[model samples]
Target: MEWKPLPVGIDDFEKIVTGDYFYVDKTLFIKELLDMKGEVNLFTRPRRFGKTLNMSMLRYFFEENPENVSRIFQGLNIMDAGEKYLDHMGKYPVIMISLKSMKQPSYELAFEMLKKALKGEFQRHWQLVSDSGRLTDADQKRYLRLRDLEGTEADYADALKFLSECLCRCTGRKTVILIDEYDVPLENAYFSGFYDRMTDTIRSLFESALKTNESLEFAVVTGCLRISRESIFTGLNNLKIMSVTSQACGEYFGFTPEEVRRMLDFYGLTEDYETVRQWYEGYQFGNAEVYNPWSVINYVDSCRLNKNSLPKPYWSNASSNNIVRTLVEKADFSVKQEIEDLIEGKTIIKPIHEDITHEDMDSTQDNLWNFLFFTGYLKKIQEHQEEETIYMEMAIPNREVRYIYKNTVLRWFEKKVEQKELSPLYESILCGDTEKMGKILSENLMETISFYDYQESYYRGFLAGMLKNIGNYIVLSNRESGNGRPDILLKYPSVRGKAVILEIKVSKTYQGLEAKCQEALRQIEEQKYEEALRQEGYSQILKYGVAFYRKECMVKK
Candidate 1:
């Protein structure tokens, strides 16, 4: 079989089709949009799920380019919908802009990026000014200011509206607007401590272009989250949102199961279907079981070159994934328990608020869960409605996301151990305050990620890592002391004053935790784990038997 170049990271529809890249047929998305005839459509899907590519496809199809439309989409799926659908193609003036590049460290820089992107769009449609004679002197000046990125804040806010009016006047037709990654600047601003400023700017921009603009025929906006309408959209009553939970346009974003099978078969990777399914499949978008398009393409590309290569977590490496880490670090006891349950192949029911803003993210546990669910960290297994509320039973979508959670937990714990003030824990242990020690240990355990299969080795490693800051003591882990190997030993050899020994046990159930703690203590006594420390001239010894059940731990001294 001849190898076709994969369209990895190439978001331009014209380039993908003309370059002969392996393009998945999502052209039917256009037909559906026309059939639904929404005044303004908002699609929220996880990043790298072909949102950009689909937006570009829409641009090429409807951007009033008759010559390129036939060449680009001649053999694609939407061409089969007959002339009624094809007649609408390339009929409207289109404005395409992507906010993906607006990810800057500060509001000022991000706003500048936004201006640059808008400037590019103006330049793309420069023919509206040069060829058409409809613009007055004032409109022409405003167009030049926007095209040159020399516009004021007000000008930039209303730039899209102005551009749409110009296009309508120039072409004698209303305009269709396509905005990709529309919430990126808002997300960046939230993380950079300038959310209000960015929100005001974006709200004004969208309010003019989408809400109040008369020249807009229709608009399609795509982003990772459906930001609250009140915050950014204000009173856009014509807005229709299609989130991950929405059945509309579900099959357009991610690759469906059948699509993945056909692609694998085309690549002579039919035998690796199960492996691919386990790693990249299982995301439920409405009724469609979808796979990550980015991961699947990369997996197939690598497998075609080298058959022995293993499937890595390709999607995890695409972005920083700091949102999930932040959510985990800020999780309360119940939230942490839910995360543990999800990691352990269990399901959790969460009330989902689809209209969440960046400001509402850390305000409540449910908002965080909703953010996770929309961002593809979690997937819906089932959903139900009560009164006016919708609740979803969510879990880790696939092995790749599960691996991300596991690694994120371990990395986050390691960082905490480095930055955490261990003096309180150390002092509690040294003063023989079992209550304080148990509280501190249990708090740390709650913060760390835990799974159902709480092995003794995992606990031993965790205990040893947490006790690394014991002052003036050498911490040894899993070393032979007397009759057997203890979990961890803190030896104050030079001072010869006091030492500490820990025996770790993992209980299957919370009810058995106390018995397991006592069993661990009995093992410490029977094995004489402190014999080596006693022989080193330590006059005092502190022993703790710690039993763990998931994230909860019990310590007996």
Candidate 2:
């Protein structure tokens, strides 16, 4: 069978349906929404999990387009629902806007981007202005200002509510409002030093559009994180939130196991099912195990073109992942242990705050964990409530996300080493100043994370990574040298005639740290670990032993 081109980045429902693109049928979502309609609904899921595409699907299904209703959704699951459901299709004036593009580096640019997006939405309904006879004079001026992209800050603040009222007046029907990535500007502002300004603007905008708007039939919003009600929603009594932990619409945003199996079978790639599952199929949405749709689709597309192609970390490649890195970098002792446990396939229980704002993230560690959980880096395995709080056991969602954590941490440490003034460390090593070396190493270790019991390989990796930029030396790790394998061997090939051998050990207590350092040096002497380097024409050789206990370290020469 010939395979249709994969809709890799296409988020438009009309394009996916009308073009030759493969689409997973999520039309039943419409029936579900109508059956359990809320005045205002908010759905929070991670990026690339079909949020945009699903919103687009909702727009195409309910927007006022009677001519193409049947043609667009001819054989979908929603059609099987009785006439009561199908009759509501394409019947309301719908307004859709995505704030994903509002992630600018500064507040001014971000606010402008928001204005530009609202302008486009207003222009979509330009008929309200062209046929001014339908609208009153006041609304006509408002529509013309917005349509011409000349609206002021106050004008754009109430843009959505104004658009809804005008559409209702002209068409004699209430309007359905759909906002995608609604928290994007808030996230950007939090990182760009403009959180307060952006929050005030967005809060006012949402208040006017969603709160007590008589023109609104219903509203649906999608975002990666659910901003706190007090922060943005602000006393909207009819608001309903369905997050990753919610059982309401969990299965709609991701691909179920049955869906993946059928998709692989359709493409004649069923043999690769286990490989795909191991990489992308551990996300637990409520009671269902769902796969990452972006990675799965990209994996299938790559395999079709090249059978031997391995599944790449496509999601990680797509994101800079600064948020995860920031959390990892600021990890205290307990947070570091939790991260290690997560990497070791163990779960840690953390209190979850479903309604968290970007500002709250920096103030509490639990909020950071909550952010990670909701953003798809971590998945909840078990949940229990005590008094008014909910605690969840979280772990890395899948092999793909675990790979992301490992690589991101390593890159962050490597970058840290590269940016530091390491000439002092090099000079100390060259001069055989073991005390200074130990002090510098200890200070550096204090700035990094350690996994307590998991210390030997961890310390060795840290040493190797920090020493990777030795000016003119070649560093080899765990290579067989003399009687046994030394931890690291730095060989200078120039006429400087210098070489260094390092052996690392870990202790359980601070008192034993010094003894462990001495023992390491004795091992270097007894095992003749430097014999190979001396035999390779190095006149002066430096042998150092390093011992670590948590963040403290001792060095001896």
> Which residue pairs in model 2 clash with each other?
none
> Which TM-score value belongs to model 1?
0.86
lDDT of each: 0.87, 0.86
Off by over 4 Å in 1: 423-443, 470-557
Residue 251 error, candidate 1, Å:
0.4
lDDT of 1 at 445: 79
Global lDDT of model 1: 0.87
lDDT of 1 by residue, 119-177 (tens): 99899999755689888999889899999988988899789999999999999999999
Scored against the true structure, residue 147 in model 1 reaches a CA lDDT of 91
- Indicate the worst ten consecutive residues by lDDT in candidate 1: 479-488
Candidate 1, residue 20: the lDDT equals 89
lDDT of 2 by residue, 267-294 (tens): 8889999999989988887776799999
Clash totals for all models, in order? 0, 0
